[model samples]
Every structure is written in structure tokens, then in C-alpha cells.
Target chain A: MSNAAIPVTEYSTPQRGWYKRNEIAITPWLFLAPGVFFFLVYVIFPIFQSFNLSLYRWDGLGQAEFIGMANYQELVSDRAFEVSLWNNLKWLILYLLAIPAGLFIALFLNQTVTGIRLYKSLFFFPFVISQIVVGLVFTWFYDPTFGLLNVMLGWVGLGPINVLGDPSIVTYGIIAAGLWPQTAYCMILYLTGLNAVDPEQIEAARLDGARGWRMLWYVIVPQLKPATFIAFVVTIIGALRSFDLISIMTNGGPFGTSRVLSFYMFEKALSEYGFRMGYGAAIAVVLFLIMLIFIAYFLWSMFQEERGR
Target chain B: MFPTPIEKTSRTWQITYQTFLPLALLLWLMPLLAVALFSIKPEADFVSGGYWSLPTYFAGLENYGRVFFQSDMPRYLLNSVLITIPTVIGCVILSSMTGFALGIYRFRSNIWIFFMFVAGNFVPFQILMVPVRDLTLDLGLYNTKTGLVLFHIAFQTGFCTLFMRNFIRALPFALIEAARVEGIAEWRIFWYVVLPLMKPAMAALAVLIFTFIWNDYFWAVVLTQGAESQPVTAGITSFNAQYRAAYHLMSAGSIVAALPPVAMFFLMQKHFIAGLTLGAVK
Candidate 1:
């Protein structure tokens, strides 16, 4: 209304060109401000805050007492923390088995059989559901007396083993559940990669008498690198942040045996067990540092690709 | 084709492959199959000698009913819907605007801001747990559904913006130039000129975020405390506690909770896959 009331000549005569350039320049920032503001407040700033908080000792509500590297020092000596760290290592190592498993499934389903597409979607079903649901499904599957695994085992006269109840096998059992969805995820990625695979190259390789593993190794594997890279990246992240399944399945128990760093951090910070915010932040920092390695690699690849463009 | 196709292989190998396909699938999905059967089986089968047997009677309705009435399953469902819907809408809207700005503009900070969102998207949520929870408390939004929705929207904007920006960047720039030539305002260029062309991207993002945020257990747990505000994931934790021996009910609950995303994936599988593999392969 005010702009309409004022004449265009009054507003646009003298400084219009300078104003227009500045206006053009500021437009992007204007568009960016809200998102950037929220990101800074919620995502970016919290990262540094958590990092700083890692150096202090505070149970969330109290005044934080600066404790330098004390939290890190205690982390070095914390046995349960060590167990969780080892379990995380176990998760990282074992979770990777899904990639090959996925490829195997993808290969099996990639054929142009009748109903193959439906089968593929059904195969990918696990990846669709939330991990919490996966955890529950597996929890029932591993139930000792009446759980599916034990019941199936009993057919061969095997005893019902309390899978989640036993500390030794618990992490494996949960990781197995995790692998269900993860493997499906990898299979989908590989399936898409397979769809895009060059037919001529395959024919050329096959004509050379390259069969079985040789064809896969010399031809297919090289072409699938990008898919494999992405699958590997997501799998690693999934394995590391594997808190949902762990939390749901066992609460990192039968005695914290199944605890990954992400779960352990939450358990430390929020659960009734204790609200050690600083300690939780310290665990988070450790997790962040570890994840940063992968993040850097991904970013470097992305940057390289951008530059190549 | 890479393995020389199964057709040209030996008949024995072909038969073996055919037989092995079902066997491998059976073994692979054994756990899920068990849950599927348990989801329908009466409590008697689990109570009796075998959990592995064919269910004597289908109690699908019974099991599902118990999950609903015997627990706060209904509330949890409602909560999941509430949290997921807004987060999807909010993240999409915010990202669209941001994506448009970053993708279309050639400013120096555009790339920087893009990277920032991309980097932030991948960080473990645990690092955000404490401060986010604290901030929620400070804002008096703790233990509220709104609190979770707000945080989820903010956190997910990082990812959504990255996806949206990349997607928008791939769009032809001539549209924007044409819009400018038409003297359409910046915001209208976005709403009228750009957004209609962005339907696929928006759909792709909606499905992706719906699944991501729906499956989100960590924030749901961190932000909401009681049954009133808690999501299905957290609700399931408590539900499992009360229904300790009710495997039948639990199985049904799991299915019900899992249904939306499963259905979403089936219905929008193409878009979901497109979104997930957006920057992955090429």
C-alpha cells in the first residue's frame, strides 16, 4: 500500500542500479536466512555445545563444573564403555556381512522370472519398516521357550536358548536383526546398480570365457563401485548409529552387552540409571570423531566430483 | 548377463539355482516369517509345546485387538501420525525455499551452506540428544508432541534441504530466467513457476522423510516422556513391559506399528528408491 502510494520515480530514480545489484546480491541470503538460522541453532550449534559439554561434569540440571579432559580420562577407564565400544566394533565388522548377503539375494532375484518384481519388493520389505519393529519381531523370534528360533531348533532336539538373555550371544543376535533390513537396503542399491549395468560389457566379458567369479570380479565389481561405495557408507552409518534395535531388543543388556556407543550415550544422559550429561556428551564426541573419518571421506569424494564437473 | 546367464548353463545348475532360490529366501526371511505366523497364531500355540507349529486357529483380529485395547497402541499410532505428518510438511516447505535459493543463486555461500546441510544431515543424533533435550526443556516444550515435531523438522531440514537443493540444481535454469523476464516476483517464481515443476522431488522427499521420521525412535524417546505424548516406538517399550508374556499381542503390535512405512514403501517404492539413491550412484 505504501509502495503504491509513493511514486516509482520517487523510489527508483537516483540509486536504483546500486540498489538493484545489492538487492540481487542479498536475495540468496534472504532465501537462505531461515534455513541457515534454524540449522545453526538446532544442528550446527548443538554439535559444538555437545563438544564443549564433553569437557565438563554436569548432570543436566545442575551448574556445569569444568573438568577438562577428565570425562575423556574416565572414558578410557570405563569398562562398560569399553564393552560398548567393543560391541560397536563388533557391529561395524559384522554389519558389513550384509553387503555380500544383499548382493547374493539381488543376484538371485535379478532374473526375469515371473513374479520376480513382487519377490524383489517382498525381499526389500525389512528395509521399509522401522528398526523398533524389527527389534520386536526379532525379540519374539529369539524368545527362548516359545520364540521361533528355539521352536525351530527343538525340531532337531536343540534346547531353547535365551538369546537376548545371554550376554555372549546378545549382540550377535541383535546385529542379525539389524542385518535383515540393512541387507535388504544393500540389495535394493545393488538391484538398481544391476539395472544400470552395461549389457555390452557383460556380453564382451562373457564371450572371453570369463565365467563365475571371474566375470563378477573382472567386470561386474568394477562397474558396481559407486553403488558399493554408497552402500558401504550407509551401512557404516547404520551400524554405528544402531541404537534403536539395541535399545528396543535388550536396553543394552542382559548386562549392557549389546550397548553400542549411541545407546550408551543416551543411557548415560537420559535414562534413570543416571543423567551424566557431560559423560554422555563425551561418548557422543567419541562417536562423532569416529564418524567424522567416514564423513570426511564422503565429503572429499563429493568435492572431487564437484570439481571434476 | 555378467555370469553368462543361467539359461546357457547346465540343466543341473539351472535346477539347482531354481531350488536354491526358494531355500535361500526361506532362510533369509525366517525371522520375519516367524513373526508373520506368530502375528496370526493364537496364544495357545505359543503356550503349548511348539512356537514353530502351524497355528491351530487364526486369531489375527484377536491379537490385533489385544494390542489396541490392552495397551496404548492407538494413542501411539496417533502420535506417530501427528509427528510424522508435520515434520514431512515442514521439512519439505523449508527445504524447497532453501533449495531454490541455493540451487538457483550463484552466491559464494551457496555451496558452503549446501555442504553445511549435507554434513549436518549425517551426524549421529546422539550428539544432538542432550542439548536438544535441554533446549526443549528450556522452551517449555518438553514431553510434548509439538516439541518433537519442531526438532524433527529442524534436524531433518538439513537432509531435506540437501536433497532438494541437489534436485533443484539439476533443473533447467531457463525457467527462472523466463520467470524473471515475465516480471514475476521471487516468491511467486518459487510458488507458481518453480514448485509445480518440483512435484516429483517433493513426493520423493515426502516418502523419504515420512519413513525417516516415522522410524525415529531416538528423538521420540528423548523428547516425549509419558504415554500421552509418546510415539509408538517408545509406547512399544512400555507396552512390551506390561504385556510381558503376551507375545501374540506384541507381534500384532509390531505389525500394526510397521504397517504404515511398509505400505508407504510398497505404494511409493519408486519414489522412495529414487530419493534414497539420489546422489548415491551417479
Candidate 2:
């Protein structure tokens, strides 16, 4: 509004000509320059640097010796790496239960009940708090002696269970803790999706005697594809990126049973374990590849939408 | 609607749902409620092995006082505020500019550039872990709050830009077109014509980024160490390691560390949810 007061022909002819000639070509870059510079330096450059570091032998401070494929070969036989990879697979598969669980909660809460708004916000409480706090809360909850889980199990005449201590069930336990917050995230997404579901189609389905599971399956599910897609992508990313919980809860303890690639990479690179920068970078590259598979699909779908627009 | 409203169902079913609602909520929030309870209990209560029982005496003030006065929690909290405020400001500023450019302009590489930002936002921090740390060390910024803030601002810009660009795209295009016809400088148009319209986006992004950077634990551990620079998230973990079996103190520290973001979430609930659900909605 302020700029509208300036007359169009008031500027000097040469300056006006230059502004007209080069402004379109130069201005956008000027706007994008700071953002693109920082993003490239911090995000884009590091991806390649990490990939290149994976092919070397460097302990972060020492001379970088080019040892091609040696780190990769070492990773192929590393037992801890194998366990971490397997645990990551388990997290990916089991974390998916959040979708159905979230949809169930969303369907239940999608009504005009009084105080439902407060209930919805309270349900989202888990996602707002730090995962470190969640990890601590669950660690205490899973305490073997006098812990809530054991106390509850005692009601059923079952023995106390060491949730984080037993190597076999440790990963599952951590994943369950992760699912608490993740399920809330998905529920909010579905609630948004449910709000936008077409009422005409639902009314038609109701008239056709589509009810219960059939109504939800045939009528509601199709309309929620966008929400489902976002939920799946985020869950996969969240599962693969599982680090804070493991670090805070167990530190990949009980013989490294719960180590996902993210935590294992940090452990190798910077923890008490001597810094093998090359080897840790190798672990990160592997994790990156796993993520890139899904990221590629996500980007492709997004590209299709951009083109559709 | 899909489940059939409880009011239309039999009275027994309606009563059952009403009864079941609170029970299910209790089960869902059991862990958090337990922690909230533990935060108030005196240390003697834990020693008695009555973990599930009501606290023998409340020690909320004592525990919280010890955390603030005796521990390094105050310094860690100050560090979080210092780190989070700058990152939020930096990211929102940078992304708004980038968002304005990408959102309002017709360019050849727009979609590709936009995809780069989108894709970068999803990549695991592990891939950037080694190089970022190395870069920080070389710059003599390792163990400094500034280093962490810089990294966060740069990384968060990707997501913020995606959000801001989409937001600007949804704004009325005619405003920019009119400004251009009036012979306004392109930057002037952005400053005068478009930026004022971005106040809501700015607010939403600020709250969301504040929560994200405050709740960040991985980078705090990766970039900074100890009480000198670590945020409250990492500080609480180390505090736990120091206290060992002192669950009461740990619970107090955890609650303190978790409060800022939780408060931010409640205060800006609408904007936070809008920012998160932006792409998920049609």
C-alpha cells in the first residue's frame, strides 16, 4: 500500500530500464540466496561428504587414508550392525500399528460429545513432550521391581518382567514406548482427514446398508488415503530415526540388543568407543540408503501432485 | 458418523461408552500420570517400596528447589532458551524469504528446488552427524550453543520453507500482480505487499520450531557436552546419570525440562496443529 503512492514514471529512465530488464532474473535469486546457501552448506553438502567419508579410514582427527570398500566389508561382518539392522526392521514393521490404532481412536473421538476437544488435546500430549522424557517415564514404568508393569502383572499372578534388561524383548519394549507418541501423531492426522471426508458418500453408503466395518472400509478408508500416506511415511521415518529413546533408556544396552543404526552410528563415532569416523559414516550411509528408498517414493508422489497442480 | 452416534444407540451402550472413556484415558495416560505423581513424592516414599501407593508426603517444592539451586539445570535451561530463540528467529526469517520467492514467482527450477528442500527435511540426522560435528570442530564451535543453533537453523529451514512456500502460494496472487503493475520494485513488493500477509504463517512456524529445537536431544549430545552448553534435555539425562537411583529428583528435572515445550504447545495449540497438519490436509 505504501509503494502504491510512488508514481510509475518518476524513476530515472536508465534506472527504470535496468530494473525492468534484470529485476525478474535477479530478485528471486536474491531472495533465495541466504536460504539456499545455508541449506547447501549444512544439509546438501554433508550428505555427499558423509558418503565419501564412508569410503575412507579416518578417526575424525587423524589423516584420512583412502581405503575403498574396507569399511563396507567390515560392516558386512559386524554383529552389532546386524543386530541394529534387524532391530530397525522390527521397528519399521511394528511401528505401523500406529496407523490402525490411530484410526480407531480418531473414529471413536470424531463426534460432538461435550469436552471431546479437551480429550483430543490430552491425547496429543505425548507427542508434544520430549522423547527423552517419554524414555525416562517408560524406563521407570518398566522397572523390574516395584514398577507399574510388574505391579499390574502381579494382579494376574504373573512374575515380574525385566522389560529393558532382557535382550530379546528390549527392542520391542523401546518400540512400544515410541508407539505411544507416534500413535497420537497419526490420530491427529486421521482426525483432520475424517473432518474432510465427504458426507454425501457416507450417506449413500448408509442408505446401501453399509454399516460397521463395512462402512468404514468401503466408504471412509478411501477418502483417507492422503492421511494414510503421510502417516506411513512419517512412521517409517520415525522408526528408522529412532535414537533418542534408545540412548536415554538403555544406551543400546544388554549387549547392544536395541541399537538401531542411528544410535549405533553415534555410539561408534563419538561415544566411549574410539572414534572411527569412516566406519560410523558407513553406518550412516546405510541408514541414509534405507531412508532414501522411502524418500524417493515420497518425492515422486509429491512431484506428481506438483505436476497435477 | 461411521460408528453410529452413541446417542442413537441403546442406553446401555451409551452408558458403557461414557464409563469406558475415562478408563481408556487412564490407561493411555498411565505412564505420564505416574511420572507427574512421582515428581511430587518425597524420596522416603520410594525407599518404602510403595511405588504405586499415594505419596507419604509431598516434596514438590524441595525437589524442584534442589534441581534449580543445587544442580546445573538453571544453566541448561538458559542454554535452551538462548539456542531455541535464535534458531527460531533465524529459520523463520530465512524461510520466509525463500518461501516468498518460490511461492510467488514463476520459475524454471521451482519444483526441483522445492523437492530438494522437502527431501532434505526427511533425511536422518545420522547422515549429517559426522560432517556437521567435524565442521563445527574445525570452526572452533564444538561445545558451543552457537554451533548448535546454527545447525538447527539451517536444517529446520528446509521444513519451514516447504511450509512457508505452500502458505504463500495459497495467498491471493492478485496482490503481487497489482504491486508489480504499479512499478514497485520486486523486493519492495515482497516487503510491502506479501510479508504483511505472512503474519499467521510466521506465528505458526515460530511455535512449531520453538518446540522442535527445545525438544531436540540428538544434536545437543552431538554438538555440545556437559553443563557448559548442553540444553535441558541432555542435561536431564546426565543429571539422571549423576543422581543414579534418585527417581524423585530425576522426575523433577524431567518435568522442568519438558515444561517449556508443553506450555508452548498449550498456549499456541491452534497454530501448532495447523503447522503440523498442513500437508496432511487436502
Candidate 3:
């Protein structure tokens, strides 16, 4: 009886401590601590650090000099920066073509023939491989002397048109290579979305005389709104983050005509030429602000969804 | 059903589609097919500039042998495995917890925290490049696979959290409520109750993160260098440089580098698609 009383007293004393009383409120904080800490240290804080670093002139090793607005002013006169900005604009506009192209392919392949699954997977093959490999394959395909493109062109009675070598069309060539994998990605998204598509609506629309383009536009496409939204989000992100293909294919070559803001920032900060940390940070800031618009839209939409729930 | 299914179409159209299917697929995969052909061709074929013709003799064995035995491809591949596997495991573990906290709990800052992850995930790698590199260097993890793995986990946690939170939200809340009614501890409920239910999400996330971390080139370049720590994506660049004009060897190397992710996709095609299109279907 005395031993039982002693054990019960020891347990009772600490059982009602603050933690026990506030378990529900504090448990989440405990669960969230490590993830929040890691995210803050890595992803969230670096954004502001990059912003602050843009205002200072640092070569990565030497003492950073306070050079507020100088970096931004230099950006105004930099020719390479101008070229990079224009290339980025081109990327943004051209990269969006993946959506419609993807929809077309999805529509084409959404059938149940023998071995169609294999065909669908094969069609989606490009998206699965690394972009580096894609870049390399496309590079060879565009080679002037012995490329298949030239080989085909020869068959059509056209001489070799050096696609990658010609500065005028270099960006377009890279964009086309990029479109291959991107279109595959959007196609998969649409395929999944099409599975969830309401078949009854299609029947109703068909009975009401909607066919082909009209049916796809008025009935099918609306059912794919969720897919379309996801496709838009990912495609925009992919467009802006097009570093691998550019780096691999052209290396911002043909008189630096293919340099996008991302590659240019890397070149400025870390490459062999020199380290202009502040300038690179400035370029990144511009790119970030551009992406900010899309991020804001996505978050807002998601927030609306959350509140609706 | 949307395209009126090929079976329901006219005979000529059906016949055309049957023929057209292989033709379109061939066109779609032309570049890859070319690379595949290149990988199997002899050096003599490349020298003769007969790239389109059948290989003079199949050198697939020799070229792939050279890539496997005569180069640093193996080392780079090993590093990729080391880096990618750890990153996938770390992200899955970290995000699952964060997802649970956000999904099941009622907290004032929940939406804001969730938004932070979503927004961070979308930010360009360039924005995080300089500072992340700096942070890695400060920790004395420069040019190390651990450095790359740590960064990938932290960064990937953003996307994984978004995925897991949404997935968890879709799960019925009655299970959690019942567990709570039985006087289970929250962490116990997470481990025993929610974790069991999260198997599908965990599987989906595992395959997705594997592909993503495996295909990563930017961070691989930024965080590590040389064959000792570099993944195959970056290693392929150096491999090409070494065999600058050797199209057969380069093609073989590229195919070797690209094979793993392709295999992963085919093996986990369902989960991969589910993970990628988490929100695309209502």
C-alpha cells in the first residue's frame, strides 16, 4: 500500500504540468519544428538574402562594399543583360505552346486499342529523361555537318541550314527542344484529368449536336479546367526555369544571344569570367519578381480553394 | 469517349489511325530514336557519315562497355544513387510530418505556413543559388554529396509538403477523431494511424522525388564537382568533352545516364502520374 501511494504521487505531480494541459496546441508546434526550421534556413531566408546582397558589391571573397542602386544602374546599360531579358521574354511566350500541343496529343492518344498503354507511355517518354540528355540529343540532331535534320533537309533538296550555329534562330531551336519534353509533361497531366472527366456531359453535349471542335470547346475543355490550370502553372514554371537545356545546348553562345536571365546570373556570379555577386543577385531579383506574379496567382487560387473547403 | 473512341469510328478512319499511331509515335520520339540508333552504331559508321543507315556492324556491346569500364560514368552514377536516395527519404519523412501538422491541426498560422511552402517551391533556383551555395560553404560541406543532399531535402520539402498536405486533407477525418476518442497520443496517432493511411501518398512521393532528384542538374553543378561527387547529369558534360567528336561513345553515355529515370517511370508509372497530377483531377 505504501509503495503504490509513492508511485501514484510521483505520476500525479508531473502529469498535470503545462505540456499535458496544452498538448493539442503544442503538439503541432513540435511536429512542425524541424520542417519549419529547415525551410526557413534554406528556402525562405535565401530569397531575402539575395535581395540584400544585390545592394552590395561583393566578389564572393573580399569585403562587400555598400553599393546600393549601383547594381541596378549598371543593369540599365549592360548589353548582355538586355539580350538576356529579351531571350527570357521569348522563352515565356514560346514555352506556353506546350499546353495546346499537349492537349492535342492527349486527345489523339485517349483511346483503348491493343497496346495503347505502351504507346501512351512511349509518347510520354521524353518527359521522364533528364533534361541534360534531352539537350544533348537535340544538339546532335541539330548538328550541321552530320545531323539527322540536315540529312532530312538534304532529302527535301534543301542544303544544311545550321540551326544552332545561326544566332538568329538559336533561341528558337532551343525552345523547340524544350517543347518536346514540356509537351510530354502537359500531356500526362491532361491524360490524368481526362480520366476524371464526366462522360455523361460528353453524351449530353453530343446528343445536343456538339461535335468535334464544338464539343471539345463547349463541353470537354470545360471539364478539363482543373487540368488546364495545372498545365498553365507547371508550364510557366518550366518556362522560367529553363536552365539545363540552355546550358547544355548553346552555353549562351552565338554571340551570347541565347542567354536567359538565369544563365546570365550564373555566368556573372560563379563562372570563369568573374564573380560579380551583386550583379548576379540583381538579375536573380528581376527573375524572382517576374516569377512572383505567377506564384501569387497560384497561392491566391489555392487559398480560395482552402477557404471554400 | 471524348474522341468518339476509335472502335466507334468509320473503318477507313480506324485503319488510318492504326497506321497513324505508330507513325506519330515514331515522329514524336524521333530524336530519342536517333540517339538509340547512334548508341548502337559502330565508330566506322560515324566516320563514314552514314548515321541514318544501318550500322556497318553493331558496336552496342563495345560502346556501352567503354562507357561502363573505360570512364568515370560508374563513379558519377554511384554518387547519384547516394544523393538521390537520401534526398527522397529525407523529403518524405520531413514533409509527412509537416503535412500532418498542417492538415490535421487547427492552428492560426497553418494557412500561412502552407502558403510559404507553396510559394517557396515555385521560386526560381537562381534566387536561392548564391545564398544556398554560401550556406553550404559555411557549413564546410562544399563539393560534397551531403551538401547537395541536404539542400535538395530542404528545398524539396516545399513541394512535398504541398503534396502531402493536400493528400492528407483528402483523407477522411473520422479516423483521426476515433483515434483521439480512444485517448491516443498525437504522435502515436501520426505513427500508427495516419502513417498507415499515408502509404499510398508516401509511395507516390517516393517515386516522384526519385525522378526529380535524379534529374537535377542545376544543383548538382552548383553543389558538387568532379566524378567523386557529381551526378551523371553533370558528368555527361565532361564525358562529352573528353570524347568530343566520338558520337558513338557520347550517345552510349547519354543513354546510360537517361536509363534510370526512364526505368523508374515505367516501373512506377501510376504513382508517378498520381504524384505529378495531384491536383489536376478535381
True contacts kept of each: 0.64, 0.71, 0.82
Candidate 2 residue lDDT tens string, A121-220 = 8888899999999999999999998679989999999999999999999999999999999999999999888988888888889899899888898899
lDDT of 3 by residue, A222-246 (tens): 9899999999999999999999999
lDDT at A55 for candidate 1? 95
Which whole-number lDDT from 0 to 100 does residue B204 have in model 3?
94
Which parts of model 1 have CA positions greater than 4 angstroms off? A1-20, A155-160, B3-16, B181-184
Candidate 3's DockQ: 0.59
> Which residue pairs clash in candidate 3?
none
Q: What is the DockQ of each candidate?
A: 0.54, 0.60, 0.59
* Top candidate, metric lDDT: 3
TM-score of each candidate? 0.93, 0.96, 0.97
Q: What does candidate 1's lDDT look like per residue over B1-282, in tens digits?
A: 544467777999888977877787788778777777878999898788656678899899989888878678999999999989998998998899899888777766667788889889889999988888889999999999999998988898988898888888788777777766555556777789789989999999999999998888989888888989988888888888888777778778888888898899889988998988776456
In order, the first chain's TM-score in every candidate is: 0.92, 0.94, 0.94
TM-score (C-alpha, index-matched) for candidate 1: 0.93
Model 2 segments more than 4 A misplaced = A1-17
CAPRI quality level assigned to candidate 1 from its DockQ score: medium
lDDT of 3 by residue, B4-114 (tens): 899998999999999999999999999999999999999998788787899988899999999999999999999999999999999999999999998888777888999
Error of 2 at A70 (Å): 0.6
